[model samples]
Target: MTTSIVIRDEQSADAAQIAAVTLAAFATLEISGHTEHYIVDALRAAGVLTVSLVAEIDGRIVGHIAFSPVRMSDGSAGWYGLGPVSVAPDLQRQGIGTALISEGLARLRAIGASGCCLVGHPAYYGRFGFSNPPELALAGVPPEVFFALSFTGQTPRGEVVFHDAFKATGPTPA
Candidate 1:
């Protein structure tokens, strides 16, 4: 059976459901620090979530993806970082995450973004035209897992600094 999946921009009301999906998606992944939801929240709070999208099936958010601007050591502009993409644990192998990523990248390019990068599994991101460029690095992250896709045909050289929100380990203090 083919399920109809709708990919759309996130609305204010989807915040809770998005967080739930993000938490459930990374809960069992050993590589996850279990702070993905917090990172999303922080990104939203900081108003730097350049592109935030949600995947809906039968009116429920089942997956989410976020893209945020990144600062490059070489002063490159229009570069964004893709990360913390999430899909419901039960729906992992489905195409939901892929759909979200495709749409998000399209939106980024439509807005004139020069490039996008992420720290993700090479196996998965490679299919999306992402590659580990020796010219780009993300500090302590291994080169094998850091991927980049240049929309403008020119990859930036130097370090890629993701938003500070990536450091969120918990909810914002009240």
Candidate 2:
């Protein structure tokens, strides 16, 4: 049977659970540096997590997604980066990730965000209207995995720089 999932903005009390879920989700992924939990914490501490959502099933947090401000070399504004999206390993392929992403994108638009971009599997993001535009790119990332979705129909041209919080690979200094 499928469990009911509730999507909502994360609360301060959910921070620890969110970190656990993120760690579990990416633990076995070969490409993951296993630092996603740190990234989320860094984003939160830096005050740049434009959108942070969690999926809860019967009071247990199972999935999470984060969006943060991104800078475009072409001087575009209101663009955000999507990533560190996590779902419980056992819950993979059950629409939890999809729900988090869909809701996150909708929330971004509601807040006047012009666009969102991410480096993810090409096949997964296409369903959400993400495409690798010729004019927009992320340095050091392959074009195929760099996808962008423009809510205002204007795609920016130039390098996309994700928030510096993405560089967090360990605990933040006090």
Candidate 3:
């Protein structure tokens, strides 16, 4: 039997579960700095978490994804950054993360976003239409690991600066 998964906008009550899922997802990822949960919290606290969604199965939160505005050095507008998507470790490879990414990308397009970029596994994100564009770069990040998908079909040319929250290294202060 196939499991049913529901993807929906995150509610305030889902905060703790989102953090737990985020932490668990990246806990064993060698490339992960393990500060994803902190980044999520900072984005929310800074009111820059433009799109935050949680995946639910059996009424329990099992995955989370976040999208926030990104600034292009060229001054192009309506671009966003996708990140920190997480699925419970026990549920990995069960399509939970795929469902979350698909739904999240649809939501970004619905919002009139010009494009979305992310630093992710090259093999995984390509299936979602994310590609490494030589015209755009995120400083300090190699081109191969950085990917972008242009909803408007016009790729911005310049450095992409994700929100400062991406630098979050600790929990948010009350």
> How would you encode candidate 1's per-residue C-alpha lDDT over 30-103 as one tens digit per residue?
99999999999999999999999999999989999999999999999999999889999888888999999999
Going through the candidates in the order shown, the clash numbers are 0, 0, 0
Provide the TM-score for each candidate, comma-separated: 0.98, 0.98, 0.98
Worst 10 residues of 3 by lDDT: 1-10
| Per-residue lDDT of candidate 3, residues 67-170 (tens digit) | 99999999999999999899999888999889889999999889899989999988899999999999999999999999999998999998999999999999
Cα lDDT of candidate 1 equals 0.95
Task: Give, for candidate 2, the lowest lDDT window spanning 10 residues.
Answer: 165-174
What TM-score does prediction 3 earn? 0.98
Residue 52, candidate 2: C-alpha displacement in angstroms: 0.4
Q: Over all chains combined, what TM-score does candidate 1 have? A: 0.98
Query: What C-alpha lDDT values do all the predictions have?
Result: 0.95, 0.94, 0.94
What's the TM for model 2? 0.98
Off by over 4 Å in 1: none
